[model samples]
Target: MSRELDLKSEKSIEDLKKLSKEELIIKILELEKLRINKNELVNEGKKIKRVFDFTKCQKRHVAFKLLYLGWDYQGFAKQDDTEKTIEHELFHALTKCCLIESRQTSNYHRCGRTDKGVSSFSQVISLTVRSNGNNSKELNYCKMLNRLLPKDIRVIAWSPVIDNFSARFDCTSRTYKYWFPRGNLDIDIMNNAVQHVVGTHDFRNLCKMDVANGVTNFTRRIISANVKLCSNNDQFSKSRGYDMCELTIVGQAFLWHQIRCIVAVLVLIGQHKENECVITNLLNIDNCPRKPQYSLASDLPLNLFYCQFENVNWIIDNESVTEVISTLQHNWASHMIKTTMLGEMLKNIEDLVPDSINKQSDCLLQGVKSKIYQPLMKRPASESLENRIKHYTKKGRLKIENNEKN
Candidate 1:
């Protein structure tokens, strides 16, 4: 009887071994489905409802310093068409961290409304937010928001300010920096040209006239404007196209596309396409009457470098500072590697080609380059600011005050 049982078992094992591969795969898939369903049930049970009562929390008015790489963002301001803005991401992070109930009720104000693709190292925003009931033992706003914010955007620090303080209205000055390569650009001439933009002037001819939005005054004071080599070592080489430089402009305020327009004219001067006196002529609205039709400089290299304020003490956390440094270093390393690779490729190509073939300036300017260069002052002009105001007024988009024309 034992021998007969053994023989039957062996026959069953043989039959199991003869099962089709497809049948085994189907059995495994069925087992995996059961496991997945069991996991889903456990996960569903683990879900918790998040409920925070904002009415019970203490609130404080504060200013936050933000740093962002704006190459991927539409702009710093929010818009109805897209949420791909720095402010949109910021508000999202604030809400996620329960810092504020909503932007509408937050009493929010920004130092500068930076345009599309413009980065900022010192963009500031003042707002009322949920506080921990003690000024000295306040919550870690930077860490909390940084956790929820995108990697490209970071909260550097925050400061408690008076309830009446406003970021936009109270800003003493703003500093903007535009980075560019020194590819065949006459840095000395560019530096000399920028000096003419300093001091108070009606810069209507140097910026887009925003009459529809009720911005009638274009008179702004530029404290200083200059171009300089970005690195000490790079200063030794003027002929090298890869060396970088920057244009730093300090101003009390700026109009739409003002810095970019100024940069476009400076670039033309640097390229020997326009005279340095072009800036002086543009500043004199009587001489220009209307802005000459010209493309603005590329917005990618522009950054809001600083915003000066009075009587504000920024509180920096050691731990958060270390983390920010680490993040910046990683970003720098990644970008540097790509830059070095491109530099090597460029060097290799230059070796194979004539030097005269690459003499053109590489600074990016918006719009197509005309084969036959037209001087900035000689280009076709846009409609005058007065005309723009009148057109908008006729369309019911703007209402000019009695003294606005002056």
Candidate 2:
């Protein structure tokens, strides 16, 4: 059936492709209204209500849970300035696949926002949908969407959910894991240190606070925390070098940069570089208002393990989300294997040295002397120690006491 035209002779019907996004939306609504009337009259066999824009302002919507590896991406949530976020890709599919209206609508809600370079195994999101029967299959929502999205992003599972099944508020808990170089990490010691993070505590100084969100509260509870060493995964003579260490964490919620801070402290204890007393001091509630002195570990090694769901009843269509799950798995597997290979190659530098003529340990340390001080000392090799001290004092950067023998 052709759409009725209201164009003047001056306007060409052939130029519809050049319409602006706003104009195109108006055009789509016009076309959809016509199609629904036609599709329903044939079946109203009169039971189906031929309502125009049934999904618009309607409570009916489909929800989805997705997964992604965030190593090469910016973050889970999208921003106006960046193109690599998970939310950006999600909205692209939503709008392009006709899943929702403009990106500003309340049609979408994700479980949590993982930071840049972080990944998720089971990230949840909810959205509204149009349906025929108590939410029938005629909606064709999942098939239509999977066909349009790229390989890296996938919709692993989805189903009709109650209007109140908010992905953010209704979540039970989240699990995260951190990987480390395995060799020197004392697994037992690290496991013991993790116990300190459990229970309610004020961790204001440990987490990186996002001041923009009005988030002055820096306290969180740890439902469970532990460290484990993977068996049968150790690097051998020919294996890749990345199998050095591993640690996992589970919590109800985490503060911004909280995982990294915890990892830094955990690794310190794992290496036995810091005593348990210092770790306890850091976790003390009275330590409040005291300045933070600990440094955070790197972000590349942390991942969002999984998001937990409750008895709200999820309808996961394995066939619908299979492609999405597989694509992400393949991408992560390939990247990890290659990354491990490169690490192994670097580890072979020790083999290049001769057994008989080993360099002194301080050989590397000597080169680390301050470049500024080296140049000044080189220029006055014969000068007295007292004179060198006097020279730097005159310039006013260093303070030193000279004890000289005549």
Candidate 3:
């Protein structure tokens, strides 16, 4: 299989010059043909392995925990005319692994549907799959799923569940964490501002009201909300320019764009543009009956941190765990190096600029902060949910006063 040329290429230029031009041309052509032949042979030897044949066994309900980076995905749920979704890829892998014949027959249920550009560390799903049968050794679900899934999506753990288990309704609570750079905004003010989010409240003004989609209930219970810095006191350190902070929210359920909307209001308060009374005003449906227009916080930093369930013990495959860890470490190292390189370039560019023309030195907060410091109430408003529902209803695009079911 060795393609070691009969004519050596490492010979000196003097040796090559000794040959006539026609001889050199022929030698070059011969070497190119040999290289192409070697590549074709190598490719011929690398055919895809045959997929595993599923066993004839009983079907069982199971739950699996997964993690994914969502920057390249449209969202966590499948949609028409789009192939770039987490659920779409998951179903594809499940089919490839012969775990489920099809999603329609699997009785599938997801814990929550994350929006585009939002990631998950412990997203869970429950589904029925062909199993190794009762009293038999269980299959390595994590390993089998990961083998067919994309590198960015990995199943870390799985558990056997009762026949009636559903990942969506059986879950008691869900937690989300939003990360952001610690910019020049006032953290204490934001922390104080966000305390209003706890407990049961009518959040019609705090979330994207989907009345047209029949989401008429605006009340939801928040278990807790906390905001904290990742480090003790590194604000003065130049090397640690982009110190991170997170706001974690635990709730029974959340509406569409709820967390992002909350974060946007908190950012407004932190910037001293909006008063803390704005939150109270929004929560009191009597005062602010409809949601005012405001930009949502960026989605890339939001993550579904944990999904809570009861009476289920997860089975971990050690080999799959190791592979998942290695994959994450490789991704982390690559991004870290790129960030460092970009920082160096920015520093060099700033240094080369004259003092008179140079703008302020920067951190990683280029698009994180609001461009204009306007009070939330003073900004131009977009159409409210009530207005949208009326407009659509008048055009016969929606049913009048329809309600969301489950």
Candidate 4:
């Protein structure tokens, strides 16, 4: 290149170097333009290369272990015309990382679809993803995904699985945890009532029937139901009023709003508005043919705690683990500091104001309190599953009649 440039020049290299400053400025501009033009030509030629070729890489079926605080999402699964979902953010990250071309081609399966405002500590999903043929220089799945996903959502671990694994069907049991604040309620009665929920039984009375979606089966087996106090510390000393208590329910599968409905009944039992017999009555479907209408417990504190699958070994990336831990620690510290400041402000207000003036029930901690205690039996009956089916049948028949007349 230097020889060619010297051959084309009017002066030898030594003479050109000794040119005046003005002459040097003109030459430098000419050279820079030439360099830029060459770069543009090279970039234009490179555009012909393919962005990605799926055929060049091998695929592996894997399960991603994830956790998220779902206060801001609609649910775990994707929905039509909505971007506020855990699956939406997950797919965006997966596509950005070139893990899967799109969700349609990924062969994805989620263990459970949690409701809006629900959270998860160990949600799992299995999908086929692009992989290095020999597992050498594999992509860091956890760190790569977490960096692209929202801070509320994190991928904790991943496991390569056999070709035929499905996250939803292969799971033996799923555990859900519901955290609540203990108010003026009886824990012993609530525990006794929860005992009846164990074993296989028809739980139509305890769930919102999705008969409209073609769900006819209401029977679900409960592995266990346990209630325990999580902390003795004064939750209200921090301005939140009740101490933390948790209810863990393990089952093979669940109905829509099943766990939340169960918590509603347990709350009534604890408040002495409903007896332990209410559970048995609800279970005896022949006697209590219809469910009574009652408000479902709040969804914010419910979490998909853990999922147990069959013999799949999980692989952990060490660097991703460190990153996830550090991120969580930083978030926790920020929230803790804010909460402490709020507590101090509340204490000062209480010191100035009379107790009578600030006697609002700690409704935020515990659920909304009933002005009058109504027994479950005395409450208005909710439409039974059979009634819902009948209503839909009639509606369909009416539509057919209208069409025929027209």
Candidate 4: residue 216 lDDT (0-100)? 69
C-alpha local distance difference test of each model:
0.87, 0.63, 0.81, 0.82
Predicted candidate 1 versus true structure: per-residue lDDT over 113-139, tens digit per residue: 888899999999999999999877899
Candidate 4 has a TM-score of: 0.80
Question: Please, what are the lDDT tens digits per residue for candidate 4 over residues 98-199?
Answer: 899988999998988998889999999999998886666766789889889998899989988988899888989999999876765566788889999999
Candidates by lDDT, descending order: 1, 4, 3, 2
Q: What TM-score does each of the candidates earn?
A: 0.85, 0.67, 0.78, 0.80
Poorly placed runs, candidate 3 (over 4 Å): 1-56, 134-136, 232-236, 239-241, 346-372, 382-406
Root-mean-square deviation of every model = 9.7, 16.4, 12.7, 10.0
Badly placed stretches (over 4 Å) of model 1 are 1-50, 232-238, 356-360, 400-406
Instruction: Select the stronger candidate by lDDT from 2 and 3.
Output: 3
Best lDDT among the predictions, by candidate number:
1
lDDT of 2 by residue, 234-341 (tens): 444433223445667777677888877777666656556566455566566464344344445766767776778776555666677676657767877998799678
How big is the positional error of residue 372 in model 1, measured in Å on the Cα after superposition? 0.8
Winner by TM-score between candidate 3 and candidate 2 = 3
Off by over 4 Å in 4: 1-50, 234-241, 346-370, 394-406
**Count of residue pairs whose backbone atoms collide, per candidate:** 0, 7, 0, 1
